[model samples]
Target: MMTHPSGLILPESRLSDLMREHPHTIPVFLRHHMVCVGCWMSKFDTVADAVWNYGLDMETFLRELNQSAQSIPPQGTD
Candidate 1:
Protein backbone atom coordinates (compact mmCIF):
# COMPACT_ATOMS: atom_id res chain seq x y z
CA MET A 1 0.00 0.00 0.00
CA MET A 2 1.26 3.43 -0.97
CA THR A 3 0.72 6.59 0.96
CA HIS A 4 -1.08 9.31 -0.96
CA PRO A 5 -0.52 12.90 0.03
CA SER A 6 -4.14 13.83 -0.36
CA GLY A 7 -5.13 10.70 1.47
CA LEU A 8 -8.23 10.55 -0.69
CA ILE A 9 -7.24 7.29 -2.31
CA LEU A 10 -4.34 4.93 -1.78
CA PRO A 11 -2.89 2.05 -3.76
CA GLU A 12 -4.15 -0.31 -1.11
CA SER A 13 -7.71 0.83 -1.45
CA ARG A 14 -10.15 -1.73 -2.78
CA LEU A 15 -11.28 -0.88 -6.33
CA SER A 16 -14.98 -1.54 -5.78
CA ASP A 17 -14.95 0.23 -2.46
CA LEU A 18 -13.11 3.18 -3.91
CA MET A 19 -15.62 3.46 -6.75
CA ARG A 20 -18.46 3.39 -4.28
CA GLU A 21 -16.70 5.92 -2.09
CA HIS A 22 -15.26 8.13 -4.80
CA PRO A 23 -16.98 7.67 -8.11
CA HIS A 24 -15.22 10.63 -9.67
CA THR A 25 -11.99 8.66 -9.65
CA ILE A 26 -13.43 6.38 -12.31
CA PRO A 27 -11.69 8.39 -15.00
CA VAL A 28 -8.35 7.40 -13.55
CA PHE A 29 -9.18 3.71 -13.93
CA LEU A 30 -10.42 4.21 -17.47
CA ARG A 31 -7.32 6.18 -18.37
CA HIS A 32 -5.23 3.24 -17.25
CA HIS A 33 -7.45 0.77 -19.15
CA MET A 34 -8.29 -0.96 -15.95
CA VAL A 35 -11.14 -3.51 -16.03
CA CYS A 36 -11.89 -3.39 -12.35
CA VAL A 37 -14.88 -1.19 -12.98
CA GLY A 38 -16.96 -4.19 -13.85
CA CYS A 39 -14.78 -7.11 -12.84
CA TRP A 40 -15.46 -9.55 -10.03
CA MET A 41 -11.82 -9.38 -8.98
CA SER A 42 -12.47 -5.84 -7.85
CA LYS A 43 -14.14 -7.37 -4.87
CA PHE A 44 -10.79 -8.81 -3.86
CA ASP A 45 -8.28 -6.54 -5.53
CA THR A 46 -6.60 -3.38 -4.43
CA VAL A 47 -5.13 -0.63 -6.57
CA ALA A 48 -1.65 -1.96 -5.86
CA ASP A 49 -2.59 -5.45 -6.96
CA ALA A 50 -4.20 -4.23 -10.16
CA VAL A 51 -1.27 -2.03 -11.11
CA TRP A 52 1.16 -4.81 -10.32
CA ASN A 53 -0.71 -7.32 -12.46
CA TYR A 54 -1.02 -4.76 -15.22
CA GLY A 55 2.73 -4.07 -15.11
CA LEU A 56 2.29 -0.42 -14.29
CA ASP A 57 4.56 1.74 -12.17
CA MET A 58 2.88 2.13 -8.81
CA GLU A 59 4.16 5.66 -8.15
CA THR A 60 3.11 6.99 -11.53
CA PHE A 61 -0.25 5.28 -11.40
CA LEU A 62 -0.96 6.57 -7.93
CA ARG A 63 0.06 10.06 -8.98
CA GLU A 64 -2.43 9.94 -11.81
CA LEU A 65 -5.12 8.51 -9.59
CA ASN A 66 -4.61 11.22 -7.01
CA GLN A 67 -4.49 13.87 -9.67
CA SER A 68 -7.71 12.63 -11.18
CA ALA A 69 -9.33 12.84 -7.78
CA GLN A 70 -8.01 16.35 -7.22
CA SER A 71 -9.20 17.52 -10.62
CA ILE A 72 -12.81 16.55 -10.13
CA PRO A 73 -14.99 19.24 -8.65
CA PRO A 74 -17.14 18.27 -5.75
CA GLN A 75 -20.70 17.27 -6.51
CA GLY A 76 -23.61 19.72 -5.98
CA THR A 77 -21.02 22.50 -6.02
CA ASP A 78 -20.41 22.38 -9.73
Candidate 2:
Protein backbone atom coordinates (compact mmCIF):
# COMPACT_ATOMS: atom_id res chain seq x y z
CA MET A 1 0.00 0.00 0.00
CA MET A 2 1.17 3.52 -0.65
CA THR A 3 1.96 4.94 2.75
CA HIS A 4 1.77 8.57 3.74
CA PRO A 5 2.82 9.94 7.10
CA SER A 6 -0.20 12.18 6.91
CA GLY A 7 -2.42 9.65 5.15
CA LEU A 8 -2.63 12.04 2.25
CA ILE A 9 -2.14 9.41 -0.38
CA LEU A 10 -4.73 6.71 -0.54
CA PRO A 11 -4.06 3.20 0.71
CA GLU A 12 -2.70 2.03 -2.60
CA SER A 13 -5.97 1.82 -4.43
CA ARG A 14 -8.50 3.46 -6.65
CA LEU A 15 -10.88 6.14 -5.42
CA SER A 16 -13.58 3.50 -5.44
CA ASP A 17 -11.88 1.78 -2.54
CA LEU A 18 -12.59 4.69 -0.23
CA MET A 19 -16.16 5.03 -1.44
CA ARG A 20 -16.81 1.35 -1.08
CA GLU A 21 -15.44 1.20 2.43
CA HIS A 22 -16.29 4.52 4.03
CA PRO A 23 -19.79 5.80 3.52
CA HIS A 24 -19.23 8.79 5.80
CA THR A 25 -16.64 10.19 3.43
CA ILE A 26 -19.29 10.78 0.77
CA PRO A 27 -20.15 14.31 1.76
CA VAL A 28 -16.55 15.41 1.97
CA PHE A 29 -15.71 13.48 -1.14
CA LEU A 30 -18.58 15.11 -2.96
CA ARG A 31 -17.71 18.49 -1.55
CA HIS A 32 -14.47 18.25 -3.47
CA HIS A 33 -16.37 17.17 -6.59
CA MET A 34 -14.74 13.84 -6.13
CA VAL A 35 -17.95 12.14 -7.02
CA CYS A 36 -15.73 9.75 -8.84
CA VAL A 37 -14.15 8.68 -5.54
CA GLY A 38 -15.49 5.34 -6.54
CA CYS A 39 -13.61 5.42 -9.79
CA TRP A 40 -10.05 4.81 -10.89
CA MET A 41 -9.37 8.54 -10.97
CA SER A 42 -9.31 8.67 -7.18
CA LYS A 43 -6.36 6.32 -7.10
CA PHE A 44 -4.32 8.90 -8.89
CA ASP A 45 -5.69 11.85 -6.97
CA THR A 46 -4.47 12.82 -3.53
CA VAL A 47 -6.74 14.03 -0.77
CA ALA A 48 -4.94 17.37 -0.75
CA ASP A 49 -5.43 17.70 -4.46
CA ALA A 50 -9.08 16.92 -4.12
CA VAL A 51 -9.44 19.71 -1.58
CA TRP A 52 -7.57 22.08 -3.86
CA ASN A 53 -10.07 21.29 -6.57
CA TYR A 54 -12.81 22.28 -4.18
CA GLY A 55 -10.99 25.46 -3.24
CA LEU A 56 -10.77 24.54 0.40
CA ASP A 57 -7.99 24.82 2.96
CA MET A 58 -5.76 21.84 2.45
CA GLU A 59 -4.96 21.34 6.13
CA THR A 60 -8.58 21.34 7.21
CA PHE A 61 -9.58 19.09 4.38
CA LEU A 62 -6.74 16.78 5.21
CA ARG A 63 -8.12 16.49 8.72
CA GLU A 64 -11.43 15.48 7.28
CA LEU A 65 -9.66 13.04 4.99
CA ASN A 66 -7.80 11.46 7.89
CA GLN A 67 -11.05 11.10 9.73
CA SER A 68 -12.74 9.49 6.78
CA ALA A 69 -9.78 7.30 6.03
CA GLN A 70 -9.82 5.95 9.55
CA SER A 71 -12.97 4.07 8.76
CA ILE A 72 -11.64 2.38 5.69
CA PRO A 73 -8.64 0.15 6.17
CA PRO A 74 -6.74 -0.82 3.10
CA GLN A 75 -7.80 -4.01 1.42
CA GLY A 76 -6.29 -7.03 3.18
CA THR A 77 -4.63 -4.76 5.70
CA ASP A 78 -7.24 -5.18 8.33
Q: In model 2, what lDDT does residue 71 have? A: 63
Candidate 2, residues 1-78, lDDT tens digits: the string is 243545454534334545554556667777766655556577676554565566777667657766776767644434
Candidate 1 local distance difference test against the native:
0.73
Query: Each model's C-alpha lDDT?
Result: 0.73, 0.57
| Top of the candidates by TM-score | 1
Candidate 1 per-residue lDDT, tens place, 1-78, comes to 322445567778887766665567787888778888888888788988989888999888877877766676433312
Ten-residue stretch with the least lDDT total in model 2: 6-15
Any residue pairs clashing in model 2, and if so which?
15-37, 16-38
User: In terms of TM-score, how similar is model 1 to the real structure?
Assistant: 0.75
